[model samples]
Target: MAKIMDRLLLLVYSIIGFAVSVVALLLVSRIIPEREAEDWVESLYGTDRLLQGIVITVSVIILLISLRFLYVALRRGNASSPSIDQRTEFGDIRISVETVENLALKAAAKQRGVKDLRARIRIVESGLDIMLRTVVDGETSLPLVTEEIQRAVKEHVEEITGIPVSSVSVFVANIVQTQTFKSRVE
Candidate 1:
């Protein structure tokens, strides 16, 4: 997507350059005397054959260069693994807060002591902020589990989305206890 956007921007600049150059050339031509302009054109063209040849050569060169660049861009697009589209806006490129929250919750759930994880994300001026509530094993130390969950969530969200995580607040809302066969046997 980025490639197309870049190409469009380049095309705009080229058009602007061409317009400016033509305007400047026209202004310079106006400053010269009519007789001098005629003489200059006559000397440059001679029998008119050279002028035609120069025009053809320059046109062919420009066409070839443009085609070469187009070919390279197409080949690169084909070679890419992800196959993303060729144009994207700055707003479209940004990751949403909801996506970050989902990633954070999933990462927290992967921790050893966590039974379940839920997260909420907020977008602040500085960056994204996440609040997580986790269910953990009753036998696990609350502080240790909370710290691990917080770290895991923060790191995973940042890595996946490339968004800076300002704060991760963990709330240990519940403790899960698993029933053991030994208790039943006793």
Candidate 2:
């Protein structure tokens, strides 16, 4: 609910900024005469109860929105990346997705067949879902290589983080050439 409110407020703030910019541009470019702009401002102060109330209410809202922006800007820990937040009896622990990706890459790199690799980790309802995209040596069996990668990544990540791994999916993107050079006899 708080996030939704923040997003809505941000959208309103953006729109207000755009509208103000447009008006300022028009006024500066003489498209809207200086006298007309002055008249619009002076009209707000004229004897009108409902208009004044509305103006006051809008001003208060904008002030609150500005304060919220300031609060967010000044707050610490605002630069955090996406992570898995967990709580235990001792304290709360956060494992960043990038860390998990590195763990997966580490596990996959130990495999003999994997030449180049990439990993992605997703937090699922059950647990973590890992995806590995890899380039393998042409001599290795695709099924065996993929299976090894999936097993190694799942076990290593779970062992290190103590987080349950729901799935580890391996994608065999490409295979590298294995060429043997023959010796020339003169």
Candidate 3:
């Protein structure tokens, strides 16, 4: 998803560059008289064919580079999740990020008053960062619930995976409403 967004942004920039280059060329041509502009261009490169070819070559190169970027972005990610590369005497060990997310979700769900849970794991300079967005019962204390969730997720994931957790960010997106007897009676 992020790769697509980044490619779209680059595509926009490339289009803008192309448009600006064309506009600038037109503006420069208009600034000089037709014959004088022609002479100036011919004088710069000696032959019009060589100048045009050079411009076309550069433009084609730019286009091809942009196409390459788009192609890579559209392609699927390498068939692997983020993990630490550890080489021991016997063999290599890898601990996937998917495992961390699943573990965090499980730990967060175990907390009191949690109604729904989502977790995302990111590789950071310090270590892994876990972000959890959750829905909970409205009657629950937001701070307490969030705190426990953060602690549980960080502790559990780090303990199981043997990877350090830099931080756990909990976002309480929504709170569910529970029915009361008085409201139903009224």
Q: Which lDDT tens digits does candidate 1 get at residues 1-186? A: 866855775686578569758856875878656777787578667867777687677667557657756776777453422211222554345455566777898888888888887888877776777898888888888988888888988888879876778999998888998877755654
Off by over 4 Å in 2: 1-5, 49-54, 78-98, 175-186
Listed in order, each prediction's TM-score against the native is 0.48, 0.74, 0.65
lDDT by residue (tens digit), candidate 3, 6-85: 67757876786888688678768786467876686776577668778877776786777677777776988766878765
Q: Candidate 2 on 64-95: residue-level lDDT in tens?
A: 99999888779886487799989999999999
The Cα local distance difference test for each model comes to 0.74, 0.91, 0.85
Top-down lDDT ranking: 2, 3, 1
lDDT for model 1: 0.74
Worst 10 residues of 1 by lDDT: 78-87
> What are the clashing pairs of model 3?
none
Candidate number that wins on lDDT, 2 or 3: 2
Error of 2 at 110 (Å): 1.7
Q: lDDT score, residue 126, model 1? A: 67
Please tell me which predicted candidate would have the highest TM-score against the true structure.
2
